[model samples]
Target: MSISVVILAAGQGTRMKSTTPKVLHEISGKSMLFHAIDAAKKISDDITVVLYHQAARIQESIEAHYSGIHFHMQDAVQFPGTGGAMKGVHVTHSKALILNGDMPLVTMNALESLMQGDADINMSVIKLDNPSGYGRVVISEGSVVEIVEEKDCKPEQKEIQTVNAGVYCVKKELLESYIPALSNDNAQKEYYLTDIIKMAVDEGKPVHPVIVEEEEFKGVNSKLDLAHAEEILQRRIKTEWMKAGVSMRLPETIYIDSRATFEGECMLENGVSIQGASHIIASHIKTHSVIEDAYIQNSDVGPMGRIRPNTKLINTHIGNFVEVKKSTLTGVKAGHLAYIGDATVEEGSNIGAGVITCNYDGKNKYQTNIGKNVFVGSDTQLVAPVTIEDDVIIAAGSTINKNVAQGELAISRAPMKTIKGFFYKFFGEK
Candidate 1:
């Protein structure tokens, strides 16, 4: 009762107009092939990826991330067609589920339904408003008889709306027997996998067709198709997050990565983008904030905050126009106009307005360590290779180049002097 999955990822995706392979093109921050592969993994781990056209590069890109994947290269010598690709695969199970890598929106429920059907062959089919170039499903006596490609169909057959979705669950033995029988006599002169549908009917194998929503089979073949698919995916993501008690003031204005996780009641204001596998918990992110690869908990950040990778915040408040990169802030409040980079601020520190940690020194970046209850005053510049220990107070407008010890007051500024009536003297108004 085992099943093998064959992912058809060999197409060059010529319509995408990029040097990168079409399956490599992303939707919602994940590659199209990965979306298909992830779903297939949920069903079965024995996946054979049929590769062609930049096959090595595709293999290299995904091999490290996805283990136990069998790659079969479809090259010129193989006469690399879909049917030709299947003929060479070494499937271990009696049943094989074939899927196209381009279709990302195919649900696991539909696939499982196909698996659970009591038939020798089951393929997912969708009824489109305009079938156009898709192969139409010919039906008779309350069941699917065969699939007719648009090029091979008559004028009446061309009017059928139910089209082949390129998703199939077939018996491996039956598939192997007829794969060589597929002919290449069409105008395109390619051995199509669709011909097997007719072959199965002729062989008296029960063909079960599972109808799905048209959007579930939306394939990404071009840049326009990619965008359309992205909209569908984003809408799905937003709806799921919303259902999980995360609030977005304007959902359409956000572009959140699919891998990002959120916990507790969080409020995301307009124009807030959270990307790259970040985690959030009970936080309020204000408008126009960009956070990538960071972790936040019970923190409030910006109407315009830019938090970069590897930053961790806890019980912190980072205000407007502040940018923090590669820093860990715990119980810190840096309200408005600051940049804290490559620094670690311990609990109960107040980083005042217009403060910056000068972490870079031309050759390499250095770290600034600030201990508990340290008060960094306004307009202060903390030069790198420095530390302000516990209960230290950095005076306003000072540029500290050296470290300050515990409970000490550090200031590096020239003495203030008065120049009376300087404006009158310069203007010659006497």
Candidate 2:
């Protein structure tokens, strides 16, 4: 059966105490709402996101990343609450999987389980030792009879250990029929989506409770909860990479972005961070190095090096304190203290320590190209719009602005003078 997805993201999230919308907060480098949408995409593409607080901003952000998403605006004045978020929304499938946007850890497997039973309403529930803050799910004869919110629960109902997991899969027709008639008679003075359970039970419709793991349903409401969720997602990402033949010295200290992927036995040392869609193929990243949005293959990057965006390294060795940005190095070795930006160093090239590519000249950026078998000595500066041809040699401490032809030597140092007593004369020494 085809199922549509409805993600409720209209809440103010006042507990989060930020100008940013709650659903926009990130977990493992992705917003919580996007995570919910991602899981929903795994099941169906007919997805609708309901928004109220900062609706325009949220819509704009989401539209930049996704297409064909149906956005619904909730009427906060006339209709308010989870049930109100679905007001006037249409579903294209037989069933609609309603999800809370704050639950970033919700997975596709857990959602697939909700589609198992043949019931009018499939509600997710988890048994907790202390279910204080959540609504209680009252079950009778293996079916959910009612859902009592925490504020209105009686003393006996308060002790119910089975709590609503805030996720539901309901028949499209039932949602269309019941949501319009929901009453706001509760203590919260809002139309509760949980009221649909009692409505279904009153008519003797089957409402099955699907028990799910607590970790997958964790909701992020405050800064503390966001941190906790980040840790959980980080651990999950690292564990999956390690299982896929990637090795890490201290897994806890290494941070990997969710969008990053590795292939064919890569290794990372302690304090290494890889971010922003980096792809590593059989490379070894040493301690304290950071790589961002770069492709590295069969290379060794420093004990303290940084590879910035748009860089590609193949069989290269970038040593300590080296930073490469927007450049490609092939079979090259830059062992220490160099910055190579907006440049390309071809095969069999050696970039000595303290070398820099003066690519930016305070107005516009330019490129520096070094051909095969080129040797750039220590403290050499290759100015922008310069090229060193094949088999060219650059002397130490030279600043070259002009291109060097093939098999030529380029040097720009001033000629030494024989000022024997210059130091003593300058210092006024005897």
Candidate 3:
């Protein structure tokens, strides 16, 4: 059955207290809205995002990342509420799965479960120990009769532990028919989508309840909520990787981006952060190191190393305090304290400690190429646009600015000078 997805993102999350829209807030390195959209896309291609607050900004941001998304600007001033957000939205399918944009942790499996129930409306509900702030789902005779808002719930209704999850899979016909007739006569003067439940029940339409875990439907309305969601998502990501043969020490301290992938037995130490589209294959990332948008295979990166974007390391060892950016190191070993940026160090090369590739000259950036069997000594600086041919040796403390031919030695250092008895004269026979 084809199902259309409608993500409601019209509310200005005032509790979040930020210039950015509430849905734009990030959890697990992606905006909460994107996470909802991502889960929605898995269930349906016909997706519509309803926006009101910062509608243009939200549309522009989403368009940069996704295509074929239909955005609807809600009339927030006149018809304001969840029901009003769907004023003129069109659904391509007979069934529409409505999701809240702030609920970033909702998974595809949970959404799919709603489709299993054969009813006019399938509403998600969770049994919380304390359903204080959420609307209570009133079930009568094995059917969901209505949802009573927390503010309007009677004393007995307040004890109902089953709360609405704010997610629904409804027939498109019902939405088009009843959404227009919704009234905002309550205390808040906002049209309530929950009212549709009582309306459906009055007409003897089947209103089924799909019970889900509380964690899956967590809504992020504040920074603390965002942090809790991020923690949950991070644990999920890390636990999945661990089950897939990737090991981590002090897993709580390590952070992995959702876009990062691991293959074939990788290990991450304490304080290791892997972000972006990094692919780690059979490698070990040591303590406090950060790997971002890089590829590593059969290598070990520092106790404090940083592998920046566009870098690839194969069978290499990057030691403590080493930072490699936009470079490829093949079968190379740089022990410690090296800055290799915009450079390529080929196989059988050894980059000594304190070595740096001066690949930038304030105005422009350049590359440093070191050929096979090259040895860059400690504290040596390879200036921009420099090349060291095969079997070339760079002496310690030398600053090489020109290219060196095959098997040649390059060094540029001032001669050492000493003044005899200078220390004794300055100390006055001390």
Candidate 4:
């Protein structure tokens, strides 16, 4: 059977109180809508998203990752809410799965369980301790009877803990057939998709309820809920990495992106953030280090290192307070307080403290190439478009602007002279 998934992302989410759209808010490294899309894609590729309120910005942003996703803009005048969003969006199949964009914690396993239920309609419900502000699920004997919105429920229904999770699997024809019957007679003056529960019941169709865990169905509507979702995601990420042989000092403090891949034993200290496709193998990542879009192997990096994009390290030691970007290093020891960008350092090179590769010359950027066994002294700056050949030595506190041949000692400091009374003449007594 062809299955289509419709994600409802049209809500303005005024409760979030930010100018940014709610679905665009990031948890871990991806948008909430993409997380939903990621799980939905596991089941079906013919997915349609109903969008409104920053729809173009949302579309253009996630398209780079999920370019195949189809979009539908909800008409504010004609179609105005969850019910209207489903009615407005187009589906390609007879049966479809409907999901909320803000529910990032909805797993593929939960969705699979819902689809496995043999029924005309499958509705996902979660048992909540405090289910206020949600549509309560009304179950009679062993069957689901109705879903009462919080505003329209009676005093007894208000006490029901099981609530509608805003996820469903239904025949597209059945749902579309009831779209015209949805009434905007509620407190919000919006057509709710939850009203279809009563219609399914009236038609005597088998409306099976799939009860999911509360955490899996948690929806983000505000900053607090977003934090909760992020916490859940972070824990999940850390646990997965730990199970895969990545050891950490403070696991709770470490943050790893979903795109990062690692193999072999690795140590991650507290406050380490590995983001955006970073690959590490058999390396020790120390405390307070940040790495993004880089590759490292058989190396030790920082208590406070920052590895920027497009950098590669092999058997390298990037120590405290060092930042590297767009560079490649092989067996290079850069121990402290240096900035290297757009450069290549060969094997057996020692990059001393406070050294900088001056890569940008105002309008253009250039590369600095250092050959094998080169020694760059402390407080030195290699002005870019320069090369240090094999066995070259750069003296301390020098600013090297030109290339040095093999086995040469390059120094740019002024000649030292002895002036016995010059200090007295210049300062008159310090």
Candidate 5:
């Protein structure tokens, strides 16, 4: 049988209080919408995401990440309500799984349980400690009878701790039939997807309750809920890393993005944090180098090289015995005591300490070019738009503003002033 997943992502999420669409908010590193999509892709061959309210932005983002998934617009403006929103979709499938876009923590295993087609209809339900604002599941004789929303439930129904988790799997033909019969007679005048449960019971259709572990059904609705979901995502990532032979100095203290990839035996020191689309491909390290929450794409580092905190790199290659601090290195070998930024260090050069290539010139910025095998003196400053010829030497404390000839020394300094008995003269005021 063909299995398809339909993800509902049309809600505007006024409660989130942000311009970004609710499903687009990130948990750990992956967007909430993408997390749900990835889980669904593992169990189903075909997946459709329904979008609205910033639909263009959501579609573009998802297309960039997963280009093959089908996209559908709920078009709340035209369709008017939830029931009518899905009216025209036609799929060539026997079964489909319905999911919400904001539940990022739902795993593939949890979804597979609901897809076991032994029952005519399966719905995920979880028992909540305080199911105050949720729809409570009503069961009699171990069979699900109905689901009552908090507002529509009677006093006794409100006390039922078992709540519907808004996930369902059913025969595609059954869904097509009942979806058209749904009514908007409820208080909000909005078509409630929950109504299908009652419709199934009335027709003597067996509804199976697939109880989900509390963690698998957590949904993100507000900023607080987003944070809670992110914590779970981080723990999952850390556990996977540990299983793959990567060592985390303090796993609980470190926060790694979900998209980060690390090779085996990589050691993240205490207080090390990796963020963005970064990866370390087969690199070893020693303690004391703090790699901050920066992006490293396709790079390797040698042991004892210090990656100063907050250094951002992309498509770059790094070597050993290098120390980078507060700079952005974009290409190969841009390391090794390299004071790069607002500067660029070419391949294969030893950047001496106290050697600064001055880039700022009062009103505008400038560049400095140093040739191969050039010895820059300690405390030397090469002013911008200047070049040091190959095999040239710059004297100590020189402030060079002009180019130097190849294989020659350039020095700029005021003549030293000397006075005999200067110390005695200063005391006598002579």
Candidate 6:
């Protein structure tokens, strides 16, 4: 039997209190709907997504990410509810696995098990210690008798541990047959997808309830819930990394994007963070090279380069003993200690300690170009738009604004004045 997945994504999730579609909200920079669709693709190649609110935009996003999945538009009048939305998708006589768009953390294995159940209609159930606000499952003789919503459930039924999880697997024919008979007969006057369970039992159809763990059934309806889900997912990912050979210092404190990759034997020390599609390949790091809070994309950091924390490096190269930040250092180098920003230090330059390229003109940014082998002296501020030619030596504590010629020593300082008798002249009586 072919297993086809149908994802019901029509709900606007008003409880989320945002205009953005709920499924489009990102978890680790990926849309939640994408995660759900990815899970479905593992089991069934035939997939259908039903869309209504923000329909055009959602369709465009899905088309950009996935090519072959089918889209079914929910008609406003004909299909007014989620159950109605599922009814609108006409899959060709396949065992239908229905998924909610809001639950991004549901595992592929759980879905596979639900699909394999192959009951006439199988409800994914989870046991809740306090099933107060949720629907309570009423099972009789090892079969689901009914799922009563909390408001309608009797006091005794409220004590039931098993609760309807809102995910289901059903044979297509039975669903299409009973969907037309569903009525909006509840407190909210909305036709619940759970109503189908009661419909099945009333007709003496076999209803099976498969118990899934509590985590697999969690759904997001609020921002707080979304944060909780992300935390759970991050912890799960960190655990997997530890199981594999990577070492993490204070894994709980690390906030790594799900897409970021690290090679084995790489140590992520406390407060060391990598973000934004940066990849590391088999490199060792010396201690205290804090790459703290950096957005490094498509660049490799040398083992000894001091990428002093809070810097943004993009498409650049960094060499040893270099401190860069609050500036863009692309294709520039300081073979030694140099504050290079808003300035370009050309290749093969030895920048001594106390070398400051003053690229700020108190009005706007300026570029200071230092040619190769230009020995910039200690405590020298090269006022920018200035070029130091090849083999130029700038004197210590000099402010060089004009270009220095090749093999020239340029210096700018006040002329010395002697004051031998000034103290005695001022205090002659003493």
Task: List TM-score per model, in order.
Answer: 0.95, 0.95, 0.98, 0.95, 0.77, 0.73
Per-residue error at 196 for model 6, in Å? 2.1
lDDT digits (tens) for residues 1-430 of candidate 4: 3688889888899999999999999898888988999999998879888888888988887787876789988875676778888765668887889999999988889888888756878998888889988888998876789987798999999999988877889987787788778888867788878778788899998788888988888889999999989999999888988999999998989999877989899999999999989999999999999999999999999989999999999999999999999999999999999999999999999999999999998999999999999999999999999999999999999999999999999999998989789979998986
Q: Candidate 5: give the clashing pairs.
A: none
Using TM-score, give the best candidate's number. 3
Give candidate 1's error at residue 370 in angstroms.
0.8
Whole-model lDDT, candidate 4? 0.90
The list of candidate 1 runs beyond 4 A from truth reads 428-430
Task: Tell me the tens digit of each residue's lDDT in model 6 across 3-111.
Answer: 8888888888898899989989877546888888988888888889999999898999999989888999877466578767866577764678888888888888989
Question: In candidate 2, which residue pairs get closer than 3 Å at backbone N, Cα or C atoms, i.e. clash?
Answer: none
Regions more than 4 Å wrong, model 6: 283-430
lDDT for model 2, please. Answer: 0.94
Model 3 ranges off by over 4 Å: none
lDDT of each: 0.88, 0.94, 0.93, 0.90, 0.74, 0.73
Task: State candidate 1's TM-score.
Answer: 0.95
Compose the digit string of candidate 2's lDDT tens values, residues 1-430: 3999999999999999999999999877789999899989999979999999999999999999899899999997888889889888899999999999999999999999998777999999999999999889999899998887799899999989999898999999999899999998867788878888889999999999999999999999999999999899999999999999999998999999888999998999999999989999999999999999999999999999999999999999999999999999999999999999999999999999999999988999999999999999999999989999999999999999999999998888899879788989898987
Superposed Cα RMSD, model 3: 1.2
Candidate 2's displacement at residue 392, Å, is: 1.2
Clashing residue pairs in candidate 3, if any? none
